[model samples]
Target: MARAAGLSRTTVSYVLNGDFRRIPEHTRQRVLAAADSLGYKPSAAARLLRGARSRLVLMVSPGLESARDTIGGDIVTRLGQLLAEADLHLVWQLGLPSVGRAATDLAPAVVLVAPTEEEAAFADLRRRFAVPVLPAFPGLGGFLAASARAQVDHLAGLGHQRLAFVRPAAPAFDLTAEFRQQAVERRASELGLPAPVILRVDDSRESAVAVLRSLRTRTDPVTSPVTAVCAYNDQVAFALLAAADDLGLAVPAEMSVIGVDGDPLGEWTTPTLTSVRSDTAAFVSDLTSQVVALARGETTTVEARLPEQARVVERSSTVGPAR
Candidate 1:
């Protein structure tokens, strides 16, 4: 580069490092142009050798297929853009055990865990890599809980006093489903309503039909028949919708339903689903800012600063209880 630009090695180095304030503008431009023509790029390994942090950010998550289907791609794109603006690179790795090798190999400036994973699970990674390991977004549990509360609030506002909580029977969703169900139960109690009946159903229409039939024919005095339902997610809600159609139950009349995760498919469903939408853009922006700050060695509180409530997208699937 120095030979091509007709400059000394020290002068070329100064220009590349942006320390050319004292050098002539023409000389700096010459070095930059030469480097550009040569297709030169800084080496992360070289930077580390020079006592500078590598410009790589490692993101780790479980190997869940649903991760990409639910806001994962959006997060990667938006967060990668933000990191690029700051001259950092983002590498997303699926699986927890693999992150140990990634941390050693990549030597990322910071490590980010998927929100679905517990931060405590990665505590050893932080100590081993001596890098910041944090949740990609803070307060994800709280955000989910708030979403569940929003469903209850929406149904309660529509005069659906008795409600049911429909959770997916999948073991993968057990932890998250528990969190959402607890929120629904708490919110209902707060609104002076009876606790929602909890029903676990699989993706199969048969599972949903059996649960619905049981709810409709309940003679137990402890809990009245529920007129509305708060589904774990759009998929669960779809199962219920299909079951309702199969049983000839009129939606939003015989039974109302609300869901979380505001999936786009909700729009195409019969009697389009009402759902609580997570602000993915805001979440990605906030998470990017946090990662950048941490990479810069800035101290940030662990507490989440995001909005406590999620927005409800109203659709045709919900309404007041029938008289």
Candidate 2:
């Protein structure tokens, strides 16, 4: 019915929200008249009693997620801070398509905190339901590319040429892998260095430890062995550190390691971790601003591609070239 009126989804949202401040008087009257004809009534009594902003944001994530990982915890904590500051309420939910979770229960909006979408049909979830469906990181591919470039660039600056990356079990929605690999290759080529190799392991401490443990027994220990690592996450970096200790391999001394996600666990490692950190605060600020702007029926032309705030905190993890 709103579509038939030749109004935008946002215009409809404004009418529903009852804040027709900017809506032209005639159009407001038409919207009201249409509502009257259609028996569209908003119960002020119910609204006053409910005391809830019909604004509910549903955060959809991958996996059953019976538990939250370390990065997940940090992101949630940061999101809560932003949501509170923005005077918004949030509800987190798993993005498992099999769960049959109903978006209908959410009052106004649904946000999927995913890198990418597998269910293409859900692209119109907003159009059909008068809600907003936002992909968290629109510049996700380039972000990953920059992240990979950060480490390689760091190693290149330090005169280390050969690097190997240890990755997590490739999540179905991994948008970063290819761009990151390409960026690594491109950087290596421009620097006249060999391309770094990627090694994938499950997103677990044990898997990370085992992969690094195996690398220590390299057959070509004399020459052309990987001297540096770009781990997928901070946890993987922790495992690599632990394995290096167990295998008696020197960090940065024998092998340098850099991790992504800027998880706090990276700090606790013995040698500390040289990591590529995300501009998470900026991301949350931009995301909340956009989502709220989108909610309030205001026009926005902002495209946020927050850059990688890559900081190479050298404690003992990374060092000068292998001499």
Best by TM-score: 1
User: Each model's TM-score?
Assistant: 0.82, 0.74
Error of 2 at 45 (Å): 11
lDDT tens digits, residues 1-323, model 1?
88998889989876665443457878877887899999999766776776665678998766343432354466678889988876578988877766667867898888877543454555655565778777665666787798899999999999888899999887767767888999999999999999789999986789999988888887767755689999988888989999999888999789999988788899999999999976777766777777777776666663334456788999999989888
Off by over 4 Å in 1: 1-38, 41-52, 63-73, 115-119, 296-304
lDDT of 2 by residue, 129-184 (tens): 54667765556666677777777888878878777877656564243555666777
lDDT of 2 at 155: 81
The lowest-lDDT stretch of 10 consecutive residues in candidate 2 is 63-72
Top model by lDDT, which number? 1
Model 2 TM-score is: 0.74
CA RMSD of all predictions:
4.2, 8.7
